[model samples]
Target: MAILEVGGLTKHFDIRPGLLGRLLSGKRRQTIKAVDGVSFTLEEGTILGLAGESGCGKSTTCMMIAKLHEPTAGTIRFKGRDIAGLDRAGLRDYRLAVQLIFQDPYESLNPRFTVFDLVAEGPRALGIWSREETARRVLEALSLVGLKPEEYKDRFPHQMSGGERQRVGIACALILEPELVIADEPLSMLDVSIRAGILDLLRDLSARLNFSCIYVSHDLSILSNISERLLVMYLGMAMEIGPTDRVVRNPQHPYARALVEAVPVPDPRYKRPIPAIRGEIARPIDPPPGCRFAARCPQAMDACRRDPAPAMREVGPGHFAACHLLDMDAPDSGTAARAL
Candidate 1:
């Protein structure tokens, strides 16, 4: 069953240049296309890994899904209703169903409150249960993340290790029994030795708890291990999306190929392909017409400069890529399975 669906979702931010910079700059106001026309779906009891560079709109997409940021265009339908249309009261109900596990553990947790108070905050804010109920639920949530309620409940954020702090963050999200979790780099800040354990904990929690997940990470290695599917984002657009094995093994888009090639391999014998990307991303403030990846894509044809949408070619069983190269109709009819 589909738990979350987002279509044509876009977010643009108004950027103002610095005082001295504006004097030298051509435009006073600029638009940052943080997320532009992204679409994807997540089925229940599965994980969708969203991977891209720092400014490629990965975090922006996560925020839109979590309802923390309102989209500039398009619809985000959860369960069935358009959550973007919800009012304050309806949004409260929406928050309980969909939760966000922020990236920074220290910034997300409350230093003033003990673990018990921090974890219980969500249930308490929603007024979902009585004080007794809050305590009971908080205890259960703490245990779910591997912390003993009695041992860790009274400790402050500063007292525990990095992994423990993150567990507290997870406990907070799980307290609401949310159906979906948008974990934005849940382990990005953890110590290297403990990162794998944290990933295992997330996989363990998702299985036993039976909730859908949007696991956002820049690291393809982690996504390959934890996600059921992967979506590659570039300049706020989805370059490719498919089953994890398919996307990682035979990436269709040039941008996706570069990312895969960049992944470090332990074996010296496995020859890595030459990376195909060049130059930094151009400003999204009125970006050039044509494929977002055109400037960076090595296989750029004259038509790519015209800006084409992903034509949905079946690269694998359900794998798809959005590139003009895959979409050109052959002279003879009927090899349609490979249409972009």
Candidate 2:
């Protein structure tokens, strides 16, 4: 079943001129297209990895899904119901079902609170469970994340290790028994040795609890390990999306290919060629109508810059890429391009 569906999701931050600039430009306002026309679906109990470099709007997309940022356009549907149309009570229900895990564990947790208090905060705030039940669940959540309740429940954020603090953060999210968990670069700050354990724990917990997850990261290597499906983004648009193995091994979009090639090979004897991505990232402020990656795409053609951004076209079964090259695969290529 599709647990969450996001279609044509967009967020544009308007840059209104200050007094001096307004006097010069006369009410001119520029818009930053943080996210534009991003679409994807998340299946129940599956992990979908959202990957891109910094400022590609992957984090912004997650934030919009979590309702932290108001989308300028598009629809966010959860369990087949449009979230934008949800009533206050309905929105509250949605919040309980969807939980967000922040990237920085130490900053996310309250330094004054103990592990038990931190884990119990959500349930207490919402009054979801009785006092006894909340306490029991808090302990269980902590234990599930590998923090023994007897040993660590009373420890403050300052007392725990980085890995342990992250475990607490996970516990805080899991305590809600959420249907979907959005983890935004959760392992980015952790040590190499400790990251594997956290990933293993997440996989184990997902299997045991049967919850869907959207794991966002800039590193394709990390996503390759944890996600079942990979969605690659560039300049606030989806460049490619498919099964993890398929996307990692056979990326269709030029941007996605660059990202796959950039992942380091660990073998001592193995040597990988440097990725050929050229040119700097394009500015998001009032960007041109053409493909956002056209400036950097090595395979740039005249049509690529002349035409508007290409819509996602199916290049293979269950694999999609947004590129002018994929138009040949479409039966109604002209119509598809016109639709965009």
Candidate 3:
């Protein structure tokens, strides 16, 4: 069974009126559909990469999963229990079981806290562990993330490098022995040289500890390297989802194809024109009906602009894509032809 199942997960931020504006228009309000109708299942002990451009709702989805943002619609099932309806004690358990690693370690970590305090915060809050047990767990977690407690425990956040701080963040997240970890661009702020080490640490720890992860990022190359499966999002909606290797090599949706083509090739000598995705990303506030990516999709049809949101369709074994072009009996375009 899947460890985490997110079905029709949606988060909409209300754009409320200011005092004068509210007085002018009594109860009127608009909404920013940050995440819309996203659904996926995450298996135990596996990493699912959520990849898209900025404002595509990757981070928003992660926040919703971590319960930092409440969902306007949909259900989040962790271990077959709906998290949305969790009571006080259940919510506390949920918080301890599902940890979030923020994008910037420098900003996320408290300047006042030492490494040991930072790592011990969760366990101490739960009040389930004695002082000795908390210390042992903190030490174990630090070691798991390649940070020695003796060397780093007493150091303040300011004393550590970006990489070390990120490791500290990882250690803190793992100290609770969470069943699922939601990492929101955890490697984006680090130096290029340090990213690989963090990625390796995450992958190795997941393997050894048997925990699932939702790795959110805009970097397709990094996701391809670290995630077993990839969930591609465009303007708050899932464009495609499948095995990372398959999605990278055989992207079915135009947006997914564009994302794959955008990955930077390291070789300076290899010169090829990268496929350009034309047009600006659609605004999230009160977005238009129909497919959110339709306006920018090269393969979009007349039906795509008029139809209600397209449903996910199986394009290959374990590979699914949301595109009007994938509908049965739909005419094959040059883009869809190439995708097949």
**Error in Å for residue 57 of model 1:** 0.6
User: What is the Å distance of residue 178 in model 2 from its true position?
Assistant: 0.3
- TM-scores for all candidates: the values are 0.93, 0.93, 0.92
| Per-residue accuracy of model 1 over 1-340 as CA lDDT, tens digit each | 7888889999999889778757866778878888889989898889999998878998889888887888999999998789978899888988898988888889989799999999989888889999998999999999999999999999999999999999999999998998999899999898889999989999999998998999998889999999999999989889999999889988888899899988989799999876878888766666667788888888888888885554556655778778777766432322345533
State residue 157's C-alpha deviation in candidate 3, in Å.
0.6
Writing each residue's lDDT as its tens digit, candidate 2 over 1-340 gives 9999999999999998688867875668978899999999999899999999888998899999888999999999999999999899998888899999889999999999989999999999999999999999999998899989999999999998899999999999999999999999999998888999998999889889999999999999989999999999999999998889988988889899999998989896988887979766764877777888888988887777875788887666677888888775565653323222
lDDT of 3 by residue, 32-103 (tens): 898999999998889999999999999889888888888899999999999988999999989989999989
- RMSD list, candidates in order: 2.2, 3.3, 3.5
TM-score, structure 3 vs. true? 0.92
Using lDDT as the measure, what is the rank order of every candidate, best first?
A: 2, 3, 1
Native RMSD of candidate 1 (Å): 2.2
Quantify all predictions' global Cα lDDT against the true fold. Answer: 0.87, 0.89, 0.88
User: Lowest-lDDT window of 10 residues in candidate 2?
Assistant: 331-340
RMSD of 2: 3.3
